[model samples]
Target: MADYVKDIRAKVGHMPLVMVGVGGAYIKDGKVLLQERADTGGWGLPGGYMEYGERVEETLKREFKEDAGLEILSYRFLTNFDQEFFTYPNGDQTQVLTPFYLVTAVKNQPAAFDKHETKAIAFFDFDHLPEIHFASHKKILAYLKTLL
Candidate 1:
């Protein structure tokens, strides 16, 4: 969690808060990169919450580096989802609003990833995507496929 979110949670204590977040679809060749999350043990796009005064693109770049060890070279806005309510494993709840992106270029790519929030990273063909962890992410990908 970001320090901003931690500070808010310290005050609110599991109360549902509306938060802004960012994520990206890094499609390479014919596959999209997905992170196997440590928290849910389910595959989803690499992303995280925005910190105070940080731009959405900044958050997306930071999250990709922290979660998957990839350096985002360039990205474009994909779509924004309506607020989606979600509960954390620790009982913290949030109404998350996400801005999704299409990562166009990157570097420092790795074949395997093991991080605090991510268990592993791999690319998957759209038709054979893993069980997605978030409803919003599933919706985003479903919508993205129409453009591919």
Candidate 2:
């Protein structure tokens, strides 16, 4: 969670707040990158919330670097959806508007990932993807299926 979000939650308690975030499906050799999130222990794409003054693409790039240490070389727009409601493990309630993308990684060597956010990061075959933890990500993958 960003400091700005925390500041807002301080006043709102558990009231649902609208959030905008971005994520990417990074494909390589017919596999997509996934991260096992430390918070949920479920596999999902590399992403995080948009910070103040950040563009949507900047949010995706920054999150992928922070969570997985990978640089996004290029990306194609996938889809955008609004999650009606979600309650985090820590009791934060939010209605998230998320934009999804299909991204290609840069050739630069990646730094070590932030263990606080990701338990593990690896690639998985789309046909045999792990159980997706987030409903929004599942919907994005389902849309990717049509393109494949």
Candidate 3:
């Protein structure tokens, strides 16, 4: 969570809010990269909420580096979905506006991910993906699968 969200939660007290989210869809050798999230203990795309004044691509690159330890070298827009509602285990709810990307990572970056937000990182075949944490992520993956 970002400081801006925390500041708003302080006033709203768990009320639903709207947030812009960006994710990277890193596909290689018929597999998609995913992260095991520390917060939900479920698998999800390695990305995060867009901070105020940041471009969507900037958010995606920053999140990939922070959460997956992969630096995004290039990216192409994949899809956008809105009104995706999610409730945190702690009870915070938000309607997320998401834009996903097909990202290419810089070569030689180690997979030393941020332990605070991610537990592990792996690439899974779309057909054999582990349980996805977010329903929106599942939808995104399904759509991406069709492109293969």
Candidate 4:
């Protein structure tokens, strides 16, 4: 979670806060980047909630770097959708409006988990992806297959 989100959660306490977040599908060699989330232990794209005054692309770039230690070389918007209300294990509730991007990674930076939010990072063939952590991500992967 972002520092500002923590502050907001301190005030709201389990209320469904509407948040805008960004995620990227970093593709190389017929594979896409995925992370095993430390909090959930489920595989998902590298991303997080947007910070105040940041553009969506900025959020994508910052989060991919923070979670996976890789910089995006370029990206194209994939989709924006309203996620169903999600209740975290800690009881925080969020309704996220998230944007997904198809991104290419900058060369020379071997992607690795940041060890804070992500437990592991790897590229997976779409047909062999691990169990996806969230329904929104599942939908995104399905959409990606159509593009392939």
**Candidate 4: residue 133 Cα off by (Å):** 1.2
Q: Which ranges in model 1 have alpha carbons more than 4 Å from their true place?
A: 108-114
TM-score of each model, paired residue for residue: 0.92, 0.90, 0.94, 0.92
Tens digit per residue, CA lDDT, model 1, 1-148: 3599889988999988999988888888878889999988998989989999898899999888877778889999978886788998899988888998999999865633446789988889999999999888898888877878
- Clashing residue pairs in candidate 3 (N, C-alpha, C atoms within 3 angstroms): none
Per-residue alpha-carbon lDDT of model 4 for 83-143, expressed as tens digits? 6567888998888998888885464766755788898888899999999988888988888
Q: Identify the candidate with maximal lDDT.
A: 3
Task: Give the number of the best model, judged by TM-score.
Answer: 3
How many backbone overlaps does candidate 2 show? Answer: 0
lDDT by candidate, in order shown = 0.86, 0.83, 0.88, 0.85
Candidate 1 lands at a TM-score of 0.92
lDDT of 2 by residue, 1-148 (tens): 4577778888888887899978888777877788999888999889988988889999988898877778778888877878546788888888888888888656478566789889999988889999999887787777776776
Poorest 10 consecutive residues by lDDT, candidate 1: 107-116
> Residue 53 error for model 2, in Å?
1.1
Ranking 1 against 3 by lDDT, winner: 3
Q: Candidate 1's C-alpha lDDT?
A: 0.86
Which RMSD values do the candidates have, in order?
A: 1.8, 1.9, 1.5, 1.7
Q: Cα deviation in Å at residue 93, candidate 2?
A: 1.4
lDDT of 2: 0.83
- For model 3, the local distance difference test gives 0.88
Error of 3 at 140 (Å): 0.6
